[model samples]
Target: MMDMRDIWIVIIALGIGTFAIRFSFLGLMTGRRFPDWTMRLLRYVPVAVMPGLVAPLVVWPAATDGDFDPARIGAALVALLIGAGTRNTLGAIFGGLATLYLLLWLL
Candidate 1:
C-alpha cells in the first residue's frame, strides 16, 4: 500500500500535468494561427481519443478470479450498435449502461 505522502505526490503531479496541458494550449494559441493541417488534425482529436479511451475498457474487463470479463464486451457491442444506428450520445450512454446493468443482473 502507498503512504499518504505518496498519494499526495501523485495527486499533485496529476494537477500539475493537467494545468501544464491546458496552459500549453492557451499559451500557444494566444496570438499564433494554427496551420491548416494542424487544425484538421485537431478536429479528429476527440474522434481518435474517445475510441482509444473506451476500447480498452470494453476489450479487457475484470473477472471474479482475476480474468477478463465478457459482460462488458457484450454491453460495449450493444452500445456501439445503438450509437451507430441512432448517432446520439444520450442513446449510447443509456444503451450501454442498460445493457451492462441487465447483463450484470442476469449473470
Candidate 2:
C-alpha cells in the first residue's frame, strides 16, 4: 500500500508527464507541415497501432485467464478476413464482434 502523499505525488507527476507529451506535439507542431515521408509514415500509424493494442487481448484475454480461446482467435480471423476483403472498418468490427459472441455462446 502507498502512503496518501506518495499516491498524490505520483498522480501529479503522471498528469504532468502526459500533458508534456501531448503538448510537445500540439504546441510545437501547430503551424509547421510535416515532410512527405513523415506524413506517409504517420498515415500507417492506425494500421500499426490497432494490431499492437488488440493483439494481446486476442491472444491472452483476461476473461480466459490467459488460456488459449478459439472464439477470440476465430473472431480475429474473421475480422481480418472481412477487413482485408472488403476494406470496410466498421463492417469488420461488427463482424468480429458478432463472431466472438456466437463462438462464445456455442463453444
Highest lDDT against the true fold, candidate: 2
Candidate 1 lDDT = 0.81
lDDT of 2 by residue, 1-107 (tens): 89999999999999999999989986889889999999999888877887898799998999999999999999999999998999887888899999999999999
TM-score of each: 0.72, 0.83
Candidate 1 Cα misplacement greater than 4 A, ranges: 31-33, 63-68
RMSD of each: 2.8, 2.0
Question: Which regions of candidate 2 are displaced past 4 Å?
Answer: 3-5
lDDT of 1 at 56: 70
- Worst ten in a row by lDDT for model 1: 60-69
| Residue 28, model 2: Cα distance from true site in angstroms | 1.6
Model 1 residue 106 distance off true place after TM-score fit, in angstroms: 1.9
lDDT of 1 by residue, 1-107 (tens): 99999999999999999999999987768888989999998987765776787787776644445456667877888888988899776788799989989998988
Evaluate all candidate structures by whole-model CA lDDT and list the values in order.
0.81, 0.93
